[model samples]
Target: MRSILAVFKREVALYFRSPIAYAIPFALTLFFGLLFNDTVTRNNQNAPADVIMTFIPGLFTFLLFLIAPLLTMRLLAEETREGTLEILMTLPMKEWHFIVGKFLAAWLYYTVLLALTLVYAGILWRIGVPDAGIAFGAYFGAWLYGGAVLAMTLIWSAVTEDQIVAAFLGAATILVLWLADIAAAWFANLSNTGEQNSVVAEVIRELGLRAHYTFTMAQGIIRAEDILYFIFMMIAGLFITTRIVEVRRWRS
Candidate 1:
């Protein structure tokens, strides 16, 4: 636990010291700020809560498609690229400690990024009443969803030594997940009117990111399965990352 905390602190310090950290958050805040402004301007007649519930959660979900890769691409890839992993492996800690520490660090940073966006929520609150439960659920869902995305990106990072390659592959993997909903629809179209078509469609949609958010968390309908899926993804990513580190340690 101490070793993991040390790694977490080190990572947090590194993020603050780097330009990429500031740049990413600034870009996100700016983009979302503009989005919120546009939403307010366009829907002047709609209730604030309605607009927020309808759009912000979906927008945050889309934002995760980009955020996950950017935040995690360097977690392990940079360590390998710079020859630091070898030196780090010489330390007494186990593989899971390092992997969890780093993953948690990145997840915390993402939470901070999400926190910065709360200004929009504040604005909505001040100007008009918003549903507390819905807003809270949306943010909670976004964080969990982003965690899963980040975990997968971390896996991609572990697979490559180059940060750019890691980022590219991570982004590509996320894009595939994002498009899974479209693929599901396309497959359903190919199938004729039968039980098989619906089954196939249902299966594919279940795998995609949107359906999960749209039907459950974003709607303030938090189910055990929906929450568990993201938790499972995070655990799987960290576990696989530990394995990768073990392999690399052995090879080196």
Candidate 2:
């Protein structure tokens, strides 16, 4: 446990010390800040909180679509390619310790990036009233969703030595899940307007990444099911990552 935490801290520190980490977060924050300030206006005097809450989660998820894969691409790929894995694997650390530590470290970095976006809330306060509850819940949901995305990216990083392949696979997987709802609809309804046939598609829609997030997060309603879904995904991906590392370690 202690070793895992140590590794986790080291991983985060390493990222912070590098230029890639600094540049990625800074670029994303500025880009998103400009976007939000433009799309979200204070004209109608509607609940600016709801608008911000919904916008931030989707925006962060979009950023993760780009950053998450790149972040985890080097997690295992670079370690093995640079020959650092040989020394690290020979340590007294267990496979679970290594995977969980690295995964947790990546997750912590993700949390920090999301936290830095809190400046948006201050902007909201300056422009209009902020919905504290909605903003908080939405960000919390976004964090969990991003954690799941990062976990899968980490799994892909372990499977291959090529960072490009890792990033493509990670992004592709998210894209597929993101489109699950629409694709499911097309499949469920042959004519695209049927009632009974669409039921099957509607059922599949619940599994879509956007659906769960929109229902729980967009409306400031945090459901246990959505939280559990993200947790389940994180555990499943990490477990598989540990299994893969264990196989490679013993085989070679």
Candidate 3:
């Protein structure tokens, strides 16, 4: 536990010190601020009940596709590239401890980014009565969504010593998953019957990152399955990362 905390604290400090950390929040603030302004302006006198939805579904998810890779690309990749991973492995700490600590640091950093967007929500509160349930669910789901993304990207980081390669792989994987639903739709359309029930299409849609969040959490309808999907992703991602690190340690 102490070893984990040591790594966590070190990584968190490193994150705050990094220019990318500040840059992400700055970008998010500008993007969300503009989005909220435009949404409220277009709506005029009556704020939409689903104002947050405007931010979550499309651009936000895309941002995650980009941001997840940027944040995690250097996590393990830098360590391996610099040959510090072997040094760290020689310590008394367990591989899972190191992985979890790094994961928690990155997760906390992403959480802070999400928290910064709450200012827009606070603005919605002053002007109108937004549905608290929906707001809560959307943000909660987004948090989970980001955790899953980070975990997945960290796997790429674990596998490669080149940060650029890790980042590219992470982004490509995320893009594919993010657009899985669209790919599925295109396949169905090609069938000429508009058959959404093709077994292949169904599986593709289910694998989409948006499928778990857009309809359910974005709409304030929280389902156990949706939550579990992200939880499973996080757990499985961490497990895979741990195994990779363990294998590397043995080889070193």
Candidate 4:
């Protein structure tokens, strides 16, 4: 526990000192600020009941596909590239503790990114009545989604010393998971029966991260299965990353 906190503090300090960390929040705020302005301008007459709903989907896509990769690309990749992994492994801490510490640091950073968008929700509340339940669910869902993505990206970061390769693999994995439902729908359509419940389609849809998030949390319906799916992803991702780091530790 002490070792984990030590690593966590170290990573958090590093994040603050890194230019990319500052740049991500700055860019996200600027882009979303423009989007909020445009939304208000277009819906001048009637304030949208839930302005959050209008852009939550887009936010999910942007964060998952673009931001997540950049955030995690250098976590372990840069360490390995600079041969710091050897020094880290020489420490007395367990491999899982190191992985968990790093994961928590990245998760906290992602949470801050999510929190920054809450200003939009507060503004919507002042202008119009937004559904608090829906907003809460969306943000909670996004938090879990981001954690899962970060965990997966961390695995890729452990696999390669090249940050670009890590980022590419992470983004590619997310893209495939995001588009799984669409591919499933296409498969159902090609079957020529217009059946949405084909076995293959159902299986594919179940495999999609978007399906789990969109149907449940995004709709203000919290389901155990959906929550479990994300938890499973996080656990499995971290488990794999631990194993990879263990192997590297042995080699060093």
Q: Each model's TM-score, in the order given?
A: 0.93, 0.91, 0.92, 0.93
**Cα-based lDDT for every prediction:** 0.82, 0.82, 0.86, 0.84
User: Candidate 1 regions off by >4 Å?
Assistant: 193-197
Error of 2 at 124 (Å): 0.7
* Residue 252 shift from truth in candidate 4, angstroms: 3.0
Candidate 2 RMSD computed on C-alpha atoms after optimal superposition onto the true structure: 2.4
* Candidate 1 structure quality by residue, lDDT tens digits, 1-252: 998998999998988899988998888888888989988877767655755754665687786767788788888998999999989989999899998888888989988988888888888888778778777778888889888888888998899988888888888887787787788888788835577887887887877777667667887777888788788878988888889989999998
Candidate 4: misplaced stretches above 4 Å?
A: 51-54, 192-197
Model 4 TM-score (2 dp): 0.93
- Residue 132 of model 1 has an lDDT of 81
lDDT of 4 by residue, 18-98 (tens): 898889889888888888878877885666556455365447544677778887888899999999988998899899999
Better of 2 and 3 by lDDT: 3
Residue 80 error, candidate 4, Å: 1.1
Error of 4 at 64 (Å): 2.1
lDDT of 3 by residue, 60-138 (tens): 6568878888889999999998989999988899999999999999999989988888887788778777788888888
Residue 99 displacement in candidate 2 (angstroms): 0.6
